[model samples]
Target: MSHVRVAIPKKGFERFEKYNPENLKSFEQLIEEQNGDTYCLKLNMHLLRMYNAYPQLVNLKITRLILLKALSKLPYQHFNFARKYLIWSQLIDDGIRVIIDMADLLENEDYEEFWMHYKQKATILPILDGFDEAIRKYICFKVGSTRTTVPCMEFKMKLAVDKEVLMKYITQLGWMINGNEVKVFPLMLNDSNDRDVIRGIICSDIR
Candidate 1:
């Protein structure tokens, strides 16, 4: 096999040999073979995760530079996922930042937009899901209310549906309709409140 250049772009790749000890050519072995290159080592997303930089990979014929190129043109870093390994945050760069920017759609509560844009990146959907769930569930956000000065369009939308009766069912109302995800603004739900978020919690307890 030929020597692979190890360049550390903004992509999430670290040379952790244990991740893929299965590979015959270890990082040490590769380093011994290479003559000289400023780029120490490089791996694509899957290769990185397989080597334990993160937790997983996508089964596609993708390349490190290609992923980095795509990520380089992106605008942000860090994304939400359902089952992610946050321990490997050190593998950050413009490329990974771009990949994380994809999570901005979920954070901004633009499901339609999110799906529309990154649905194709679904090859890495599992990884994306990990980050998405991690981000949305942990980040604190409050439901919108007329009494509060902060803008909460999700809450306001509930108010618009039926100002008087909406509050009556605010906690249980189905104000959002993006695909099959009926719950609206679930990330901001606080179980104590009598609004959209709390209703689901109370209903589950009753059942």
Candidate 2:
């Protein structure tokens, strides 16, 4: 079954939050605000684990070196920077992957290598926009396809898979993957005027 999904803006909200302290009343207030913001959700798993294992360590260090290496291979090199930050800060590696994938799709023009990664599930769907029209055409052309890599958003076309096949692959590295029953709220990235914001929801599982 498709699982529940939610998308938030690639709003660079975190960067703004980090740099724009004056936007809020106090630094503590800023932190509290982001706790509910989608951009800051990646801290949940580590935060939860910290309370149990070592409450003394306010900052957890993950040192996910392998994941960091993977991030460097993406089209947009900025992901390598983001990935390094996550590893250094002990944030989820999958979150790093998702961010890199999304950034590559949004900023980079190359897709051939990117497609190869998605084919292997080494990368998740990136935050992309500007291909809704192409998506419609791909859906019409491909049938019974497990996944399709198109110019727009990347999609996994699971037409007749049962719950058993579904269960095995439901877990996403950064976000949670659900079955056909999953409901995703679209985050609109494109408008007639401004450049399309990066589309795609941030799956809670991944965050």
lDDT winner: 1
List model 2 lDDT by residue over 1-207, tens digit each.
333322223443353333232322232222233311222323322232332343333232222222322232222232343343343334444544544563454334333444454456533433222222222222222321223222111233321224453333333211133433332232222342211221111232235
Supply the global lDDT for candidate 2: 0.32
TM per prediction:
0.25, 0.22
lDDT of 1: 0.35
The top-ranked prediction according to TM-score is 1
Count clashing pairs, candidate 1. Answer: 17
Residue 143, candidate 2: Cα error in Å is 25
